[model samples]
Target: MYNKKSREQLLKEYQKETFLRKTVSFYKYCTIKNPQEYRDSLYQSFEQLNIFGRIYVANEGINAQISVPENTFELFLSTINQDPILQAIQLKFAVEDGLSFLKLKVIVKKEIVAYGIKSHEYDMNHTGKHLTPVEYNQSIQEKDSVIVDMRNYYESEVGRFQNAITPDAHFSKELLPMVANQLAGQEDKKIHLYCTGGIRCEKASAYLIQKGFKEVYQLGGGIIQYAQDQKKYGFKSQFIGKNFVFDDRMSERITEHVLAHCHQCGTKADSHKNCANQTCHLLFIQCENCAQNYQDCCSKSCQEFVCLPKEEQLKNREFENKRLTSLKLSTKFRPKLKGLQKNAV
Candidate 1:
């Protein structure tokens, strides 16, 4: 049996916990006869296990990235394994710990990865060959190998494999097409792809292959699993900088190489952050100094906006919405990192 507290109570317990927990992610692509029933059953089971993370269920499949207590990790694994649909699924474990998420969120969505592609566009049975870290490292050295990063610009900014071609698209919907177009001429080349975990590459590789790519390969478990395997295999990590994650942890350093600049100071830093202003949470990177100086706001305008009275802020947001409609300014703001004191260095 499992127990669950309210979201507020869960936050309180997290604050008081003394033991370190592990953040892990896994996903599987399978046809579901009834998504609603599947979603409800999964929610009931995972919640009981006391798991904390975000899960997206859809007709296409399931995608999840979560953090669970080390004590219940085995139970969590066993619970999922017992499921007929999820049994024998290969989970990609994270190499570093950042306490990625604070609470559990199970959501039913349209598509697990949300590529906006029709269901008939990709064949899940024909995904790229999964290569371990050693194989990925060796394959890239071949004369015709082309490595590509299949993540958002912000995610690749923090950490990515050396010489990996990063698509300039900002959102997931645009990423697939841009990557396909970029590698159009190199169809016969040995195309190697990777993402934070293996999910993005899993679909991207299959899509590319469908688009005529001949020798497509994906890093077995993305960088997370690659970093873990590096310990035992003693292979020099080709990835440089921190691996950006979606949860509260933000990013994890994978190597000594820092190839990114601080978004504020343009210095040698690769840390990613969301603007601290609740009203406008734009995702970007800022160094420690900039983080301290700006209090995590994306700009001075946001800094000033956050200090206004609640009513005044609401009025201003309404006004800005009308004014910015023609200009099409994004209202998204970066959320403040939890557990860390607001604006406290």
Candidate 2:
């Protein structure tokens, strides 16, 4: 029911495995009779298949981003498809992958995507219209339609649609309400919504409708599908730059455009990294040069602290982050990476 190995041991094991792994994400909003029972079974099934990733199971549905062994993909697929709740569901494969996860974690939560809205706020049964990637491209260009990015500010900071109404939201709980406020007088306008995997948009579009907004439409499978469509259909991507992912890889480049600048230095860069200093693990954009100069740390002070004796590090760990915060050290983005070849996409 749990991994017996330490984090270091797990990382080493993942690195040593020679098998190809496929990183993918999927979600569905469906009824579940018993969430705890389902969670237990799901964990057992994924564990047997040597799966590694995070998953959330609730009375509403399931959401997961997992890494599967390439050789056992079919087995994983067949096993998953057998569940009535998950059968015929669409899966979004990562555009690029590295060591996406080190351990498998299945949690039981109140909501899968965490919009923090009450039941009276949304009606999933009467949700927004679904638009294919090609259809989305055509519709978004219309003068009357408004494209809104239903994702966190940091996620959108790295990549987003050209003319999107990206809310300055730092958390999912605040995004929908902020978006509603932003579109206050535009209830009659055609509201277009999208998120990483289309999950967030599902609830958001519905909420907009409940708020008296008409003509709500969501990107069918979100950006993951859009990127695939662009590659296969040879259409210019409306969304540019890196798609920030919740994984070790941080992001996957969607185009050649470097939309973000390094937090430490102002050069164009899109790579995201947490400060290597355990006491000051602030997430920010760091260029390779700064990464080397600071030893993968956010500030020189923290870098120096990391080199102290083990007992010293422990003694200062509690106060280190507080001191850094008081001094306003390290760079922070607006409420908030990857390098890719131009011709690769």
Best by TM-score, which number? 2
Question: Which 10-residue window in model 2 sums to the lowest lDDT?
Answer: 336-345
Off by over 4 Å in 2: 324-345
Which consecutive 10 residues in model 1 have the weakest lDDT in total?
336-345
In model 2, the Cα lDDT at residue 260 comes to 83
Task: Tell me how far the alpha carbon of residue 279 in candidate 2 is from the true structure, in angstroms, after superposition.
Answer: 2.2
lDDT for each residue of candidate 1 in 95-134, tens digit (9 for 90 to 100) = 7776666677777777788776666777889999999889
Displacement of residue 298 (Cα, Å) in model 2 is 1.4
Positional deviation of residue 45's Cα in model 2 after best superposition, in angstroms: 0.7
TM-score of every candidate relative to the true structure: 0.88, 0.93
Model 1 alpha-carbon drift over 4 Å, by segment: 1-10, 309-311, 320-345
Candidate lDDT (C-alpha), each: 0.77, 0.84
